[model samples]
Target: MKLFTCTHCGQLLYFENSQCEKCHYPLGFEPKQLQLFPLVAEADGRTYRLFGTTQPNAPTYTYCRNHADGVCNWLVPAESATQFCTACALNRTIPNLSEPEHRLRWWKLEIAKHRLVYSLLRMGLPVVSKFEDPEHGLQFDFLADASQDGGQKVMTGHDNGLITINIAEADDIEREMARKSMAEVYRTLLGHFRHEVGHYYWDQLIDNTPHLTEFRALFGDEQDDYGQALQRHYDQGAPNDWSQHFISSYASSHPWEDWAETWAHYLHILDTLQTAHAFGLSVNPAAAPAELGLQAAITEEPYEISDFNRIMQLWLPLTFTMNSLNRSMGQPDPYPFIIMPEVVDKMAFIHKVCQQAGSSAKAAC
Candidate 1:
C-alpha cells in the first residue's frame, strides 16, 4: 500500500496504474523488486527494459498474460517461461468475462487480489499457485451466483487452498446491502481476501505443525464442530459481550473464524501503517491528554518491524487520525472496530505465527 512513482517522469502512481499520466510513459510493476518502473519496449515488441537503465546487462521482463486486458500490471522476468506473474498465476477460475459486468467485477477483484499478494510477498511467505501444488497451493475462484440459472448461490469462503468469492461482492451496491443485512461495520473485497487467505495459511503453516497447540490455547479448540457452531451462531447471535474477545461478531462464531478475523485485522494494521510511514505521517495533538495516546511517530515500516507493540504504537494513532478525517468529511469511520486486550492477544499470536513462517522460508532459501 505504499506510494509508487513512475520512473520516467516521477509522477505519483497507484499500484494499479498501467501508464504514467504526466509523461505518458508505460508503467509496470516488478514484484520481485517491489518496484514500479517505466518500461522501454524493445523493437521485437515482446520484451521491455527498465527506464533509465543504461547498463547493457539490465534485465528484461515481459508482461503477464493478464496484462493484455489491463487487469494486471505485474512484470514477469523474460527468462521465465510462465505466462502469468506470481499473483495472476494463482487463478483457478475467473468469472465469465463475456458479460460486460463480469469483466469490470473481475478487474476490481484483481486489484484487491494483487494488493493481498503484495503483502504476502513482502512477508516472504510462499506464493505457490494451485497448479504448482494441487493439494495446498493458493488459488482463486471468482464466481457468480447461479441462483438466476436455478443453481446454488456461490458462497464466499475458503476450502483447502481454494478461495471462492461471489462476484457480486465486487459491486458496491450489492456489497453495501450485504453489509447492512449482516450488521457488519466493515465489508470490502480486500477484507474478504485477507480473511480467507488466513485459513489457507493456517493449513500451510500451522495445521499439524508445532504451533497448533499454542493456536488451540489462544483460539480455543478448532476441533469443535464448525457447522453446528455456525448454525448456532446464526440462530442465537453472538454474545452481547462479543466485542470484548473478538475482532468482529462473526469471529465469535467459531475458533477458526476468530483466527481469520484477527488475521485480517493484523493485515489491515500492517498495510495501513505502511501507508502512514510512506507519507511520513505522525499524530501529535498539543491539547490532547498524554494518556489518550494521540501522539505517535511512524519511523519504521510496520511490515519490517518484528515487535507487535511497535506495530500497535504506529497503528492506533493512525486509526485515530483516519477516523477523525472521515468524521470531518461527514463520512463514516474507515475503521469502525475496536481492539481490546483479548483481540490484541489474538493478533499478537498471528504476528508471531507470521514471523515463524517468514523465518522458515528464509532458512530454506
Candidate 2:
C-alpha cells in the first residue's frame, strides 16, 4: 500500500487510480516493476512505458496486454512473452465476461484478488497459480458455475492448489446467504482470497517446510479425517466449549478449519491494525481493553508481528471496540470470531511464516 506516482506527470496516486488527476495520464500497477507507472501507447496496439522511466531505464520496460484490453493493472517485463503479467497470469479461470455485467463483477474480483496478492507479496508468500505449476505451484480459479437463481451452481473452496469462488460472491444476497450458512463473522471477497491462500500456503509454508512437526504440534495432527470432521460438525454442531478451544464455532470442525480460520483472522487483524495506524489510532497496548479509539491507527505497523504478546495486547481491545462500533451501527459485530490464547500462538506462527516469505521476496528483489 505504498504511494504511487503518475508515470507521465509524476502526480501522486493510488493503486486503484485509473487516471492521473494532475496529468491525465493513464495509471496502472506493474507487477514486475511492482509500482504504479505511466504508459506510452502506439496506434499499432503495442503499449508500454519505460521501466523506472522517470529514473532512466533501471530495468527494461514492461508491458501488460490487459493495458490494451483495459482489464489488468500489472506489467510484465519487456522480454516476457506472457501478456497478462505475473499476477494476471495466475488466473486459472475467470467467469464469462460475455454477459457485460459479468465483466464488471470480474473486474471487481480481480481488484480484490490483486489486493490479496499484494498483501501476500508484502508478507513474502509464494503465489504460484495452479496454471503456473499444476503439480506444485499454488494458484486459483475464480470460477462461477450456475449459483444464482438463473446461473449454475459453482463450488467455493480449495482443492489441489485451485480455489474456485462462486461469482455470485459478487452478488450481495447470495454472499450474505453463504455467510449465514457458514456462520462466519467477516465474509468478503478479500477474506475469501486470504483464507484460500492460507490453504495454498499450508503446503508452501508449513506442510512442505522443516517446521512440519511443529505445525502438527500447534494445530494438532492434520492427518485426522477432514471430510468426516465437517460431517460431524454439521450433524452434531460445535461443542459447548467451542469458545474455549476454537476461535469460531466452525473451527471446531477440524484442525484444517482451525488453521484457515485463524489465518483469515490474522490477515484481518493486520489489515485493520494497519488501517488504524494509518488513521492514527492506538497500537498494541500493554494491557487488555484499553480506552477505545474511534480513529484508525496513524501509521500502520503490525506491533507484535509474528509474536503473540503484541497481537493479543492489540487485538483484545481493538476487537472490543470493533464489536461496540458494530452495535452502535445496529449491525452484527464486524468480527464475530474469537481467538483463545492457544489460537494466539498459532496466529503467531502464521505471522512468522509470512515474515519469512516476505524476507525471501525482499532479498530476491
Best by TM-score: 1
Instruction: List CA RMSD, all candidates.
Output: 1.2, 3.9
- Residue-wise C-alpha lDDT for candidate 2, range 308-364, written one tens digit per residue: 566566666677787877899998888776677788888888787778777878798
Candidate 2 residues lying further than 4 Å off, grouped into runs, are 1-12, 38-45, 50-63, 67-70, 147-152, 283-300, 303-308, 317-332, 360-365
Whole-model Cα lDDT of every candidate shown, in order: 0.91, 0.71
Q: TM-score per candidate, in order?
A: 0.97, 0.83
Model 1 over residues 189-304: C-alpha lDDT tens digits? 99999999999998887799998998888889999999999999999999999999899999999999999999999999999888888988879978889899879999898888
Clashes of each: 0, 24
Question: Which candidate has the top score in lDDT?
Answer: 1
Q: Stretches of candidate 1 above 4 Å error?
A: 147-150
Q: Give the TM-score comparing model 1 with the true structure, all chains together.
A: 0.97
